[model samples]
Target: MRKLITDRRLLFGYILAHLFIFFTFEQEKVFWYIFTATMLILISYSILDETEQRESRKFHLFIGILSGALLYGVFWIGDILIDLLKLPLSNQITALFKLFSPELTWHYLVLFLIIVPGEEIFWRGFIQKKLLTHTNPWTSIVLSTLLYASVQIHSGEFVLILAGLTGGFVWGILYAWKRSIRLVIISHLVFDLLLFWLFPLR
Candidate 1:
C-alpha cells in the first residue's frame, strides 16, 4: 500500500476525488471549492518531489506554461475538426458550460492555475510514470487514456468521457516522449480554457 501511494497512486486518488465531487455535489460552486483544494494539495506534493529530485524548479515551471499553450493549440485544432464534422459532441460541451454558468472570477483563477497544475501532476507525472513501471510504453499509454476517460464518467458526461479519452491519449504520448509534466499540464489547461471561453455555461 505504501509503495502504491507513491506519486503515481496519489494521481489515481486525485482522479477519484474529482469523480466524487462531480457525483456528490450538485452545485457548481461546491465542486469548484473541492477542485481548488485538491489542486493545492497536489501542487504541494509536486514541489516536495521536485525538491527531493533536485531538478530545476524554474525549468519545470517554464515547461508547464509552454506545454499548456501548445496543448491549447491542439485543442483549438480539434475544435475546428469537430465543427467541420458537425458532431453532436459540440452540443454536449455547450451544455456543460450552461450547467456551470455564472462562474465566479475566482473560479477561472482556480481552473487555470490550481486545477490544471494539479491534474498535470497526477495524470502525467504520477499515473503515467507508475503505469510505465509494469507495462510497455504503448500499453501504458492506452491504459492511462482509458483510465482518464473512465474517471470522468458521470450522469450526462458521455461526451466528456470521449473527449477525455482522446485528450488523454495525446497527453499521455507527449508525457511519455518528453517526460515533461509541464507539457501535458499546459495542453490540458489550454484545451479547457478554450472550451470554457468559447462555450461557457448558459
Candidate 2:
C-alpha cells in the first residue's frame, strides 16, 4: 500500500484521473468538454508511459465483442435484481444516464473514438498492468478497480460508482488475460454502446 502510494508514476496518474474526473462532474454545463479533455490527457499519458499491445490480434475483436455482450447481460441481471428488491437506485441511475449518455451524434463519435479507448488503455492497459509488478494479478485488478471506482466519487451517484467498479473489474481481468488494449477497448466500446444507446436500463 505504501509502495503504491509512493510510486511516482502511478500516483501521478491517479491524481490526474481524480482531478479531471472531479472537474468533469463538477461542471454540468461543460461536462462533455471536461470529459473529453480528461480522456485525451489519459491517452497521452498512457502512450508515453508504456508500450502496450495496440495492434489488432487474432480473436481479439471477436472475443471483445462477445465478452462485452456477456458483461451487459451481467448488468442486466443486476438491474432486474435491483428492481425486484425495490432498491432506491433507479433515480440515481437515471440521473447519471441523463448526464453521461450521448444525446448528439458528435457525443457518440467522441465516446467511441476517444473516451472508451482512452479509459481502457489507461485503466486496464496502463494502470492495472503497472500494478501487476507490485502485486499479484488479482490484487492488481482489485486495486485498479477500486481506483477506477474512486474516480467516479465526484459524480455523486452511487450507481455510477458501482458501474465503475463492475466494469473496471471485467476489463481488468480481460486485460490481465489478453494483454491487448485493442481487445479491452473494443469490449468497453461495445458495452457502452449497449448500455448508453441500444438498450439503456432506465
Candidate 3:
C-alpha cells in the first residue's frame, strides 16, 4: 500500500488524468464520452486489485432506495439555496442545458449509461479506495470528496461545485460505511437522474 501510493508514475498519471478531464469539460460530447471510457479503463486496471471484485455484503435494495431519496433531498435544498443566493452558476447551468440539446432519451442514456456509472467507478471505486491506503477512513472520504468537487469547480459554477460537494460527500460516506460500489453507483445514478433530468435545479 505504501509503495503504491508513493509511486511517482502513478501520481503523475493521476494528476494528468484529472487535468485532462478539467480541460475536456467543454469539448464535444463525443470527446467527453471517450475520455470517460478511457479513464475508467485506466483507473480500474491500474489501482484496483482483486478485492474490488468482491461485492459489498452490506448492500440492500431498500437501503439503496432510501439513500437515493436522501441524496435527492440534498439537491432540493441546494436548488433553494441557489435561488436564494442568485448564484451566477445558475446562468452557466442554464447555458449548459442549451449547449447539449440532445433528445431527452439520448440525454438520459448519457447520464445513466456513461457519466454516472463512469464517475462512480473512477471516483469511489478507484480514487477513494486508493486514498484509504494512506489515510484514515474519514480522511480518505473527505479528501476524495474534495478532489471530486475540484473537478466540478472547473465548470466555473459555484452551484455546480456545491452540487458536486454535496453528492461527493454523501456518496463518500455511503461507500465508507457500506463499502459497496454497487450501492454508491445506484445512488449516484438516482441523484443524476433526479437532479439533471427529472427535477433539474436550474
lDDT, each prediction: 0.66, 0.86, 0.70
Q: Which of the numbered candidates is closest to the native, going by highest TM-score?
A: 2
Residues 14-122, candidate 3, lDDT per residue (tens digit)? Answer: 6755676666665755644655565666555545444333447665666667788888997687657767899766677677656543445765676677667777777
lDDT of 2 by residue, 73-129 (tens): 999999898889989997787777777788899899999999999899889877987
The candidate maximizing lDDT is 2
- Candidate 3 yields a Cα-based lDDT of 0.70
lDDT of 1 by residue, 1-202 (tens): 3453465545645565565546534555477776677567655654454322221233355555565566556656766777789987778767766665337888788787787777778666766676666567787799778876776675357766877887788888877766767667767776677667654222
What order do you get sorting by TM-score, best first?
2, 3, 1
Colliding pairs, model 2? none
Q: Whole-model lDDT for model 1 versus the true structure? A: 0.66
TM-scores for all predictions: 0.70, 0.92, 0.80
